[model samples]
Target chain A: MAYIKLDREKCKGCMLCISVCPKGQLKEDKGLNKKGIRPVRFLDKDCSGCAFCAIICPDCCIEVYK
Target chain B: MKKIFGRTRSLRGVDTHYCQGCGHGVVHRLIAEVIDELNIREITIGVTPVGCAVVAYDYWDFDCVESAHGRGLAVATAIKRLQPDKIVFTYQGDGDLAAIGTAETIHAANRGENLTVVFINNTVYGMTGGQMAPTTLIGQKTATSPLGRNEKTEGYPLRISELLAQLQGVYSVERSSTDSVQGILKTKNAIKAAFKNQMENKGFSLVEVLSACPTYWVLSPVESLDWIKNTMSKVFPPGRIK
Candidate 1:
């Protein structure tokens, strides 16, 4: 069940992490993050446990439970 | 349970020839891990440059070729274009990449050749008696710059990643460091991405790894890591440059 997360406060919601997910499991939640950018939302159920989502993330805002 | 030692038989245990606190070993291991994980041991061809990583052929157990200082990328480009079926990658140091091979690196990237560049930027030239490298930071002391690199005279350090990323032919370009555990892991992933992109026929890929040079930099291994973490990160930051 170990997968991924984007801390709401830390997530800049740049959409880069969502765009780079090889599995297309991440989505944008037009809702604002702490900085008011569209926060990156995750489809935890579809996560393949691949860390590409975490690696391409520029801000190091990704946390993979695995 | 974690696997012990290297995952690729391509890298036989010869006890690395690299000096302590040198990032070459870690970089080498990252390449090995990628080759093993991708199951491309026989297909991978590595081109070594004339620097600390020159003897990479001796350690990495794959098809290897040695090239002159700063000419590794040129050599790898030729090999890759001729043998596009093979996975071609060049392992180069800062002196080999930024200084002597500037034209080769820029043109190769501009051409979008299907090859991978594993650039180890240690700031100062390590093999050539610690000479001032193109990436040497201002106010940083080297053998050639006893009074530190005077930006007024020597000019500022060249940011290779930022420059290379601007080229249209490049498939991807990124920078990572080996100073910390997480950073080192990220460095491996970056190199893996470069190689993977090449395998997927994406075009030219370059992964600039900010490494520590204890012998050349005249700093203790621990101090060098600290310097890489605090000093180098300030200028390059981390993650994708492209």
Candidate 2:
């Protein structure tokens, strides 16, 4: 099993991670974060453990585990 | 589950002030990761430039010095010489390295300063509100070049990696980008190589990273990355130059 945790407060909502995720597990959340930006949420589906999203996250908000 | 990725200890547990989708944050993380992996955080010193990443020291947990605009290499050279056992590096932007500090960078490389230089070439001066930098592509529009950069007037984009590679004192030179997953990985590896070269007593290593400036470019973060891939890479191709 693969899992990724996101620090929503640190997320800038750039969505770069969403674009790079091979598993399409991330999506933009409708709720605003502390910074008043829409944060991304993981779909909690079958993650491939590629870690592409974590790698591309400029804010360093994501941590990946496999 | 095994932890595959997390923030490195070399970086402070604080969020960076970089704008949304900025490449500086990604580059910072990569450097921090490299420092942790190499176990050199305690002996590493970073020189921060006067551009967008001017306050890079605030995010990095290691010792850092602030340099005057474009004088990053000069300060870094002094630091490396005085403390030969330390791993010194300069994090400079396109405007700081290729324009105001060009002479310092060239002289440092020519003298083989035995330091690492992480050059962020984002085409425009991102911090000062999108001014045309020395690396700005021809026909690209910036605040200073509102009418678009003309070849006859602007001359051409300065390819710093290629120019520095020509110096005999330079040990290694590589150009990488932050446009894609592979490109980001390559950039991290290039940074690691530069740091390793310094540790191995190899003289002057420069890794020029073609980064994105979404706010300055008047494009979305993703679009700016695409521009770097499809447009900027054509002029500053990613690869080893020396």
Kindly report the docking quality category of candidate 1.
incorrect
In model 1, the Cα lDDT at residue A24 comes to: 84
**Any runs in candidate 1 off by more than 4 Å, and if so which?**
A1-66, B1-7
**TM-score of only chain B in every candidate structure:** 0.96, 0.98
Cα lDDT tens digits for candidate 1, A1-66: 556766666555445456457788888786786565666788777766666555434334566765
Write one digit per residue (lDDT tens) for candidate 2, span B48-161: 999889899999999999999999999998888889999999999999999999999999999999999999999999888999988989999999999999989888999988
Where is model 2 chain B poorest over a 10-residue stretch in terms of lDDT? Answer: B10-19
Cα error, candidate 2, residue B54 (Å):
0.7
Q: Can you give the lDDT of residue B185 in candidate 1?
A: 83
Using Cα atoms with residue i matched to residue i, what is each candidate's TM-score against the true structure? 0.77, 0.99
Clashing pairs in 1: none
